[model samples]
Target: MSTQIITAKWIVTGTSRDGDIQMLDDAAIAFDDGVILAVGPRAQVITAYPDAKVTPHPLHLIMPGLINAHHHVGLTPLQLGAPDSPLELWFAARLAIRKVDPYLDTLYSAFEMISSGVTTVQHIQGWAMGDLEAVVGSASSVMDAYADIGMRASYSYGVREQNRFVYEDDAAFCDRLPPETAKKMAAHLHRLTMPFNDFLTLFDRLTDTKTSPRARVQLAPANLHWMSDDGLLALQEKSVAAGVPMHMHLLETAYQKEYAARRTGTTAVRHLEKLGLLGPHMTLGHGVWMTEEDIEICAGTGTCICHNCSSNLRLRSGTLPLMPLLDRGMTVGMGIDEAGINDDRDMLQELRMVLNLHRVPGMDPAEVPSAGDVLRMATEHGARTTPFGPRIGRLDPGCRMDAVVLDYDSATYPYQDTDIAPMVALIHRAKSKDVHSVLIEGDVVYHDGRFTRVDRDAVLARIAEALAKPRDADELNRHALREAVFPTVRAFYDGYLQTTADRDPFYKGSSRH
Candidate 1:
């Protein structure tokens, strides 16, 4: 295929050798057959590739596409009637959410993500209910949605072997409830249960039958409390054998920390390290309550972390010690989780939130995140946590040509001081509406407020029509069970952490206090 060159007023190529943001002014990128061939000054590129067809965006800033390193579900929980609550109680409340068609639901978020310059997402499918075949079918729909929309996705079926509800055995927890509620809970758990081997089969099936090059399946251990020790070890082995990475949720809340102590008499990180599950291939999601020692373990093991700032705040999970993680030179990716603070999946807004949220007390400039650091989290660092890895993160030679073009004029409308750096200005001023175009695999999938593949409005309308129907008997029953057992679920964690001194306060009071 002939080379295509895209020129922009400014280009953020990637990070430099010194770990700073790399930028090229009046630059152009030349690609052929979906791989970058060269990125340099516009005049140099034009002279070198004189015959290449050039597309010029003199007022745009082209940058590597943003990656949502951690994501789950399509419709926000609030839209599905699950109000923000503590992480433990939120699971119960989510059981009542109205069912949505997996394809349309996935598309709903894909549209939002693409509009905000997110080109890839690490979609961890969790809480899937039904037999193996049915679960596989739902997973297929999710993958198909991304393929149809021309967005890359790293998908994983969460391997949850135990503790489907509370951080206890399913049978044991059900036995403690009222007889009727016990029966209902047992039935509900039964639907979600599949043999451990079936999870392996599901992984093999997805691995062997991937429909699109844009989609790759990985493994997720779900959470520390959600999996047994044996299951986690087996998963680690499977991940190594298959050459795929694993994203596991760990220590998102103080209660989870307490649960880990109660279960293993140690921190979750130490327990995982003992089981040989901590490594570069492993990404721990929401390390909100990680202790200093836990951080050290992760840092030593080269384990990645996906920081879900909005989810942590929304679920009342404590803020992650992001500054310390960065200080340790650990790789951290950005994730919006179920939804961002505005109940939408907007990566740009999420980046801004992450940039400002960790500004702790005292005036240590080194403690605060710079625009380059936040961008790295959303782009290259986020990419590390996914199966796509380095291939799709940077706009460098040998990397996949996945990028976003922002209308610099629109982003800094009225006037922007010339002295202000482009990267800093875009981070603070850019909105989703300023996204001018998006390219994936050298193809323009979105441009000038339109998607090249699939009808977003039509898909959204179908979703609205599907959910407009009245609740069915099965739906009503689930809602009733959720209501009947919410208090019980909440009570399960009452004082659960009160007795544990292992818990660390998110903030320490001043000496005067």
Candidate 2:
């Protein structure tokens, strides 16, 4: 195996313990194949491995690559014409916009995500492709796209099969279809949990064959409110059977909480518990409305929660009690949640947002959430939210050789020995442009601003053209998508009659849903 060494001014490895934690000035790392063979002071490593290729990262800060614990990479196109109002209003708009594929959406989102120092993403794709088989097939094709780009992805073919709005499932609109379309779709979705299924299967296989292990694979149950009782139960069963972590949006808003409570006569978390779904295998997203009891349940079940700071803030969903969650001993990861909200895909900035959002009046920023806490959320804590944990987060010898080097000239540069140096420059000053290089599973995928494997510009142009293609929605769909879909969706929520006083203790006079 060939060896390479990267020397930097500071190596602020996101670590807690002093020994394994690396912060070497004038340090050099020796790498063979795709793994970090050794790390120490520059002269020590270089003198020890005379034959190793030496590359100076040149006045840059070396750190672990960023992980986006939550994503719907191709779903950004769904936001194009989404409604003007909050939550439900936007859901209607999102539903209309989803029909447009353009294929470019996935490439565009991926490029943006990679450029921002995010080497890994937990991906969920396509709500409209309800038939299980079609979902698996389409997702397989998308995985092919990711492999070419050298992304370490935890991908799942999202299966949210519910018989609801016409826009949600439009098999009837297909003018011509194979007689076995229904059977095909069902078989495909079911096989999603079967061995080597959908996107996850392809990713897992690639890593296993790894002449060197290359990528990460994770399974997601999509989100709660989107799935039916049976579907949710199946996801839990399937996830446990596969020994993979389950991802889902737990409680993002009052509407979801109330809706689930009414249907199940209990909170969503409790309902899952009754179904024997609560366990270490589950990783939930959001949890904005989780009751104290729910938080306790999460702690007991050993479930990790990924907080998508930008999406929640973008949709005006209230800020989460991060300090409280930390106090409760629940692991938390950070996420961007596609569509470039928080405005961009920069995880460092998102981490900074996590810090600032949790630190408010009277609450001392130091006490509420330190920079170290946010940094951990982006790495170790973030990894827990996916199937691959400790293996990828740290810079230990055996950990995946995935890390990012931040340029010292960036706005967040000149990190001092203070507690905030790592967090401030990381969260505040750093942007994708400041990223000097990125390595995932022992390979450099992003060198400077260019992706090493994929042609970013060509992929982007194709995406722009395809995104523009989906807006027209054809015939019964095209006309209905533009004019009737939003109102119909809005009508479903608006027409929902409330029979009882909201059980929520924090219920306000007005309903945001």
Candidate 3:
């Protein structure tokens, strides 16, 4: 590709040495062949690359693209007929979800993500109802969607060696059901089963055959309850040997904490530590139920965490100790897991939620998240959790030219304050509609309310057409099974926590009830 210069009224480059966001006024970024060439004042950049074609966005603010550090599905569970419930029970309710074409389903979310300034996503795919080959096909479709849309994705097929539904073995849990119900559940488990070795094979195959330069394969150990000791060790070993990071779900709910304690006689983080999996290569998702000691262990080991703020609230999982995690100097990333609070993948909205949610009643300014901190979490810190690393997160020399240009006028319309920083104003006021352009690898994938590569309206129409067809026999059977198992799944978690203290809220509310 030929050289091009994109000049904006303001440019917020990556963070500085002191952990503050680096902003430049009337700045320009010159890039060629998907790599950033220079980023500085417009005059300086123009002088450096004098012959480059320029595209000026005088009314826009350009910044590093946001990263969704944790993501699962495209059409969310809510869209797939699964209502919000507690995390444990939500798994059972999710069984009723009708299967959609993976490619179309993935594109459905990719459109939402790119429009909302999310250029890279950590897609933790799981729950494919077939053997190893079918799972691989599903994964390929997911990755293909990202590649076709010109977006970056770090994909991992979540490894679930045990505990597919609740925090119990499949056979053991099935045995607890009625005779007929047990038979169907057993057959369902059998269809989803794959040899442990096949997981490694899947990882190796994906790593070797990645179709897009913008896509990379990583490892996910699903969750603590979902993994056996041997499975966790094997994944850890594979992670180290492959030199790719592993993202695992840990301590998302109170019951998960109890399950970990019951299983290992220790916290989940401690168990991972014992297995030599606590390191920079591992990222724990949610971490809402992590103790102070757990936070310290993660901090000491440089393990990352992805705070799925919206998912926690929607699933009633509990609010994360974000302030404590920040105070400990932990590298935390932001994610719109499943969907944001608005039932869509809007990173800007999620950023504001994270920024305001942790503000305690006290008037301590240092305790709450700053605009810079939230920006870092969405950009630099989020990039650290993915296999894409530093390449796609920031607009700097040698980094890929992935960025979002927001219409400053639109974001700060009808009123204004010159005293407030641009990043602060955008975080608090900007919506996905204010996103004017999104560039990935120097290609303008989305610009002026249109995608360059794909016809979004046509794609959505195709999806609607596909879902309009009658549910197949398998789909109908799964729906019936989900209804039958829902009550039993709910009953299994009755008094699951050992003590009243465990059931009490982790967050101390400001109200004097």
Candidate 4:
């Protein structure tokens, strides 16, 4: 295999020991055939491999590419008129948006991720629509987009067997609504129903493929409240039988915690354990409401958590007890759910947000997550939630050569600090514009403000044109129905909460409190 050596002014190898990242100055890395061959001081590597082609960067910081552990369809709910409301009502707003081609939608987000130094993503496909063939085609479109862009992705469509909306049955919810409004709601929501056999069959067909190094298919049972006991078990069975990872949303909202108590008379985590669904192969997304007992269960079972800091905050969901989770040595990954504070899919900014969000009001230095911890969460630990795991997170020998090059001129040039840690500086200052290039498997897919593989401008223009079209009759009706159901859904949660005197012990109300 032909060899290439890339030398940078600073290389932050995301290999942690004890509690610090292993970093090198004036470092050079050699790779061949998409695998890292060696990483060390510049002079030694250059001297050892004199014949390897050398690419020198005198002002760059090289680090592992970021990983998005929990993601969904690229289109942000907020952009689609879903305001900053409770997640339950937010769901209604999302249902009101116009439909776009899945391929274009996936590619649109991939472009943002690639430009912002993200090399991998876990796309939790929520619910597949249309007939069986159409459903499979939609999934294929998403996977094909990832392959075309050369970004590694773990894709799974979440299955919901019951409770599509509200905590009760569909007929009951419809019965409560006015006849005309009920008609619209049922017509829109009823199509979500699909046989369990059909769901698994589609997943099986999508996963049965000649595996690409860039993509893998997994299984997801939408959420703890959305699935029946039988549905969860069937998902567990299928995940085990197919030998793929399982990722599900667990306790994302306070209402969900209530649902767990009301339905199963216990915490959702314990309920999953009872159903034999908690295991090393499972990853729980947005575990913002997990209690101490739930944490213990997760720690014991080796189930992982993906920290989507931006999503939790945006949806007004409580923050995950990140420090405690890290202290227990539970694996946690970072993600920018739908959008970040800037309403964009920028991982670099998300990294900074993750660092700041968890630093509670305490003088204990240990309470704050350091830059290394944040980096690992965005890279190696994040990999655990997907099929990639340790293979693509580090820059050590034998690992896949997935990395990002930051122009130090843009990140830390005018007043370079030799005393401050590289990652600390990066967390505070780095932005997507600082990304010089992003590489996956040693191929430079994004370089110097341009994507090497696809016509970015054309793709973006097509997305704009598609979204700009007038809403169809169904889309228009969805908007009307969402408004009609929004208040009822809010009332449902209010009444449900009144049934119990339990208050969220973890989340202190916002400053307004």
Instruction: Find the candidate with the highest lDDT and give its number.
Output: 1
Global lDDT for candidate 1? 0.91
lDDT per residue (tens digit) for residues 126-233 in model 1: 778899999999999999999999999999989888999998999998987899999999999999999999999999998898888888999999998889989998
Per-residue alpha-carbon lDDT of candidate 4 for residues 169-197, written as tens digits (9 for 90 to 100)? 78888888889998988876767777888
C-alpha lDDT of residue 191 in model 2: 34
Residue 477 lDDT in candidate 3: 90
Error of 4 at 72 (Å): 0.6
Error of 2 at 69 (Å): 0.8
Q: Which ten residues in a row have the lowest lDDT in candidate 2?
A: 167-176
On residues 120-195, what C-alpha lDDT tens digit does candidate 3 reach at each position?
9999998887888899999999999999999999999989888887888898899788899889988988888889
Every candidate's CA RMSD: 1.4, 6.0, 1.3, 1.9
| Clash count (model 2, backbone only) | 10
TM-score of candidate 3 relative to the true fold: 0.98
Expressed as tens digits, the lDDT of each residue in 211-275 for candidate 2 is: 31344455566556556677667666667666777778777866667677767888888887787
**Candidate 4 wrong stretches, greater than 4 Å:** 498-501, 507-513
Say which prediction, candidate 1 or candidate 4, comes out ahead on lDDT.
1
